[model samples]
Target: MSDLLERLRGRGWRMTAQRRVVAEVLDGDHVHLTADEVHARAVTRLPEISRATVYNTLGEMVTLGEVIEVATDGRAKRYDPNAHRPHQHLVCGRCGAIRDVHPAGDPLADLPDTERFGFTISNVEVTYRGICPNCATTA
Candidate 1:
């Protein structure tokens, strides 16, 4: 994510140490973490980092296209750093685990032309919800 940091720096983003730490926290971990979760982890590394700072940094990153937000439900939104790739998400219905997935077909094709009411369609996000293996085994 050094490249991302450099790009953000070139874009005139204030490279505060807190922001760098926040970026490192997201970059080092592959899992999708909610803002609260991210703040919790960041606190361990930099106790002075406030929740607002983390939230602001995350919002800026999202706006800059350096991150993506994934919502498994109506609850907290998780941040995904794998923004460079095009993929979908498979969410566990019972345990809330999320796995990145790649479907075989173009998802946009599934939206039949008849469904288009003359509006320009841009993108699609498909989330498949099911019981994960570990959760299934427990049940």
Candidate 2:
């Protein structure tokens, strides 16, 4: 996403070739790539790109709100580029495939005030886990 790079530029992010490659790897619909995956892909374009550089670039992107992290199984975190949209994640418990899903109602509303515990409620993220079509067919 060139737009993302431009926005990062506007925010004074130094444009590096490695960061650009990483961003390109992240740009697309339903893209949920882990850091190792990102580094693997980025290495194809930037053979010199190190894992530390990729991690730093990802951290910067997250700080800039250009990417959101999803911990599907608490093992590895996936980076989502669709930060502007409000949605939840549907993860395949078997194959670990992830899909973005939109629910019909307000999920946060399900938590009534009684359960708020006197803290300010701001946002909600729901992760639905099940077998994906491919995984189901294979099984």
Candidate 3:
């Protein structure tokens, strides 16, 4: 079972055929697929599945905190299923590929009291941008 599917089932999320297809399409490491891309893949598994269904399922998953919506490069919002883990993004500037990167310490602790402007910091999002190996080799 995919991590996203397992988490959804554990949370008592209703498992419809369309939702299941979407979850399966999103199952994998470094998965950051846009709604259209997800819909395209879901159509391969279940021919009757609609684009709206994929969009709605993704929205619900994002709302439920089971999936994370990433808008890298401002092209389209990509859905990430690795929400249960704490990690950052490494994006390829040339090809726009994204990968999950786990750096050493706690980012929350890195912010000192003096640097914080008084609001409580609940989370942090870090994105490292550079050319990926494939793009670098091609260039």
**What tens-digit string does per-residue lDDT give for candidate 3 at 43-136?**
9999999988999999999998988999888888999988888889999998898999999888889888999999888889889999999999
Q: Provide C-alpha RMSD values for all models, in order.
A: 1.6, 1.1, 1.5
Best by TM-score: 2
Judging by lDDT, tell me the better candidate of 1 and 3.
3
TM-score to native of every candidate shown: 0.91, 0.94, 0.90
- lDDT accuracy of residue 71 in candidate 3: 81
lDDT of 3: 0.91
Ranking by lDDT: 3, 2, 1
Better of 1 and 2 by lDDT: 2
Model 2 is weakest, by summed lDDT over 10 consecutive residues, at 1-10
Q: Which stretches of candidate 3 lie over 4 Å from their true place?
A: none
Per-residue lDDT tens digits of candidate 2, residues 48-121? Answer: 99999989999989998999988999898899998888999999999888999998899788998999999998
CA-RMSD of model 2: 1.1
Q: Candidate 1: deviation at residue 77, Å?
A: 0.7
In model 1, the Cα lDDT at residue 72 comes to 82
Candidate 1: Cα lDDT at 7? 68
Give the clashing pairs for model 1.
none
lDDT of 1 by residue, 1-139 (tens): 4666776788899888888887877873357999999899889989999999999999999999988988888899999888888889999999999888988999888888899988799889999999999999999
